[model samples]
Target: MHIVICSSIDFTPQIAQVAQGLTRLGHTVDIPLTSQQIIAGELTLEDYFAEKTNAGESARRKIEHDVIRSYFEKIKMADGILVLNFDKKGIANYIGGNTFLEMGFAHVLNKRIILYRPVPEMLYTDELLAFNPEVIDEDLALIR
Candidate 1:
């Protein structure tokens, strides 16, 4: 199966590990562009986010638009998405705003939605559960 991983860019290392595991399983994996760039040292996570955080509204809009579109295209090309949900901000299996949006896209695209952990406890947890993502509980083999 071909899988596109969806997660916070902060989890680049863990995403790489998951991607490798999926690759070993004979599955083609595509990670978040930022994750790939960060792992490759082509991009610095802090600076990228810092710029976005401090940018003017228009600039931030443009940045977000470009990024969201790029990833949307990637998700459309893949067979499914592997959500690399990890603990963040004291929330176990955290799915932040962006990861949630990506999953929403995958769900709309009729792609398989696999979660590395159970649905998280967040404001949008109900909406996330509505997507019906398959929880694999960190078992890469269970992704498919």
Candidate 2:
């Protein structure tokens, strides 16, 4: 199946690994530009976050809008979304704001939602549970 890998920029390495595994499994995979940039050594996660933080409000808004719009288009083209929900800030199976938004976009598009790990206790736990994403538990083959 064609799958788009979504995760925080902080997890780009892991996302890249997952993408490689999925590709080896004969699945088509797409990753966000942030991950691509990081993987290509064009920017570090710290630099990316710093750039966003240092940008003016209007510039930040435009950047965010463009990135999200691009991802929405990607989701529309994909068969499903595989979320790399690694633990963050002591929250196991943590899904951050942007990743959660991507999940919502996939859910609305009726694309299958797959999680690298099971949904964990979180602020929006109920909402995430409602989407009923398939938990692969680190196994890329489970995406099907």
Q: Across residues 1-144, which tens digit of lDDT does each residue of candidate 1 receive?
A: 989999987788899998899999999988876777778998787766776578584356448658788889989999999998999889999998888899999999999999999998899999999999999988887765
Can you give the lDDT of residue 88 in candidate 1?
A: 88
Question: Which stretches of candidate 1 lie above 4 Å from their native place?
Answer: 49-65
Global local distance difference test of model 2: 0.88
Alpha-carbon TM-score of each model against the true structure: 0.88, 0.90
Q: Which candidate number has the best TM-score? A: 2
lDDT of 2 by residue, 1-144 (tens): 999998987888898998999999999999988788788998787787677678584357448759888999999999999999999889998898889999999999999999999998998999999998889888776666
Distance (Å) between predicted and true CA of 120, model 2? 1.6
Model 2 weakest 10-residue run by lDDT: 53-62
